[model samples]
Target: MLRSDAAGNALGAGRLKRMIRYTSLAVALVVAGCATKDDVDDLALDETPAEVMFNEALALRAAGDVEDAANKFSELDRVYPYSEFARKSLINIAYLNFKMGNHSEAIAAAERFTTLYPGNEDSAYALFIIGESYFRQIPDVGRDQAVTGKALQAMREVIQRYPDSEYTKQARQRVRATEDQLAGKEMEVGRYYLTRRNYLASINRFKVVVTNYQTTRHVEEALYRLTESYYALGVVNEAQTAAAVLGHNFPQSEWYQDAYSLLQKGGLEPQESKGSWLSRAFGNMKLL
Candidate 1:
């Protein structure tokens, strides 16, 4: 009976030790949690309010500290994403980046603003910034025209979607400018192929200008080149059709004279074929 009592006492002591260990661990966790919460509170105290931060960013921009202003605007967006000041800061960030010639960054910020607030009045401004950024990045005609295409698309969106907005006029101008650039690119490639006697490839490129970019200055040359290419390819009827269309549209243009002269070399005069693709493309348009 004495041995049994001793065993019981030893087991109770073992259980008591486990309980003390568990209590100590619980207390440690509680203290750690309090410390973490205090750290968070301290960090919150360091953060500026959204309105104050945005104003500071504007001040920085007014003082010609554009880079610093952009950083401040971004910080406001990160810290107070749902605040009204944050929304304003987003559009301002796009404008500031554009002023600094960070065109791609400007486009990204503008696109984000449009995606988040599609119906907002500022959305027009944001889309205008996107189009302007792409316009600023447009390369020369000899370079790839992918950026020019993007500019045209973006600007056209601003014009079509927000016709009454202040940006619409500029957007229309940019649209025309981008169209000219794209047409110039097509003409450059067509000229290259034509110089190499790749008549079919050249004709395809010229046809793009004639069909899709008729308003561009390059269309006169495009039509003349089309006449040259078809005649070289032994498609004399199409050549006559091309030259007839060119002469009809741009009678005083040097390109029309050149087209007429070229056709005369092959004993053909400019005569329209009613079934020509050129006729279908320009027949209904007021090209004159």
Candidate 2:
């Protein structure tokens, strides 16, 4: 009886040990399987061909998934750096970054494309993209206009290097817009100085508009401000010359009318002053 009882106890202990071992093995296998699945999910992109990855990025962009599309394009370029698809991917990434309002990234990618493929037909487009990125970041005239200046420089590069490109027309338009923005910035500063009763500083700002950005929309206002500043400084001849230039260039402008009225209230008339900077400029143009 005692021997049978001992034999039953040993048999039960062996069965328990075997069960624990099997359970541990099963748990370990499950954990390993999950870990492998996680790795596979992480590396799923590794198996895709460059063309396939590029196409996927394009589809994502078309579907308005800009962030994902940019990531995929970057991934494609990284995975196949020497492929033609990689080169194309870089350009698409630039455009996508621009669309995503990532102006700095767009500029970097566009610049990179231009650097790598200087002779590519799309280099003009890349340069245009850089200009557009900077142009879009241009702040209000009340703020700094450093980005506007950069946009002008980039757009000028496009027009100068690729005159016949389709991008040149758009770049030229952007250049004009950037110039207007810069002129507007100058006008803002000039008006501030004028309001502060600093006629000399005001004249300097307004003169920049007239001399450097004469073709901008702000020219009429700048000329009117110049007239106001010179009059405030008690320089009647310069005031009259400024008013004359304003009237000559923008005869139908409200600014011209305002200048004329202000000069009339001072019992003075608009006339070109010989030997003045304005006279030299307008005289050369035969407009005075």
Candidate 3:
């Protein structure tokens, strides 16, 4: 009976050891399968050359694995900082991050590239990317326009520094759009103050649109609003001058007709006041 009992104990110990071994094997396999692409890239970093890593990143990007591709490109840059591939990788990283909707990251990468290789042929592209990053973040005209301002500044730099670049054309177009957006914001605020019967405050806002954003579509309406605001403030001469500027700039505009009607209702005519700034600016030109 003692021998049989010992044999039973040995068999049970063997089974327990086999179960532990199988569980460990299964855990290892699961870990291997769960290893992320970044983890794999990390593991290969020491073994892979920068060119190979860059190519891998490109392949991954083309395959629509943008996050992993960005990781691979970043790894290449980190591990081979002075390699030619490193510079190329930074540019790709910027563009890929932009495509991935990581605007801040895109801007950072592009800035880094431009700082490190300002004279490189692709530096214009990096600058363009920075401008585009800010441009894409511009909110509606009714919202704050700080980002629109930034976008305009960046785009202006692109145009001035790289006038011959292909990006310059697009930058010019974006500048116009950004300017219009800023003018729209000013118009929105002016109209809001007008609705609240704040004539002085509203006039200041509309004047910003007229003076700074004259090329924008908001200028016509700004001139009309200025006429209305000046009239409301009992400044009939300034109101008439504002209406005169509106008519001279945009005679066919509905805003001009409205301004003319408003001035006539106030027993004033739409004629330039010699003492007014609008008249000083537009008086030498023939009135339309």
Best by lDDT: 1
What digit string (tens of lDDT, one per residue) describes model 3 on residues 1-288? 355878989878856754665456556655879755554433433437677888899999999999999998998887677789999999999999999899999999999999999999999999999999999999987789999998899899999999999999999999999999999999999899999999999998988887788899999999999999999889988898888888877889999999999977867788777888777655474544
The parts of candidate 2 lying over 4 Å away from their true place are 1-52, 55-65, 283-288
| Better-scoring candidate (lDDT), 1 or 3 | 1
1 or 2, greater by lDDT: 1
**Candidates' TM-scores?**
0.82, 0.75, 0.79
Order the candidate numbers by TM-score, best to worst: 1, 3, 2
Model 3 scores a C-alpha lDDT of 0.87
Q: Tens digits of per-residue lDDT for model 1 on 1-288?
A: 356888999878866754565456556756787545554433332256577898899999999999999998988886677779889999999999999999989999999999999999999999999999999999989999999999999999999899999999999999989999999999999999999999999999999999989999999999999999999999998999888888888899999999999988878899878788999998753322
lDDT of each: 0.88, 0.88, 0.87
Error of 2 at 5 (Å): 71
Query: Candidate 1: worst 10 consecutive residues by lDDT?
Result: 37-46
Task: Name the lDDT of candidate 2.
Answer: 0.88
| True-vs-predicted CA distance for residue 125, candidate 2, Å | 1.3
Worst 10 residues of 3 by lDDT: 38-47
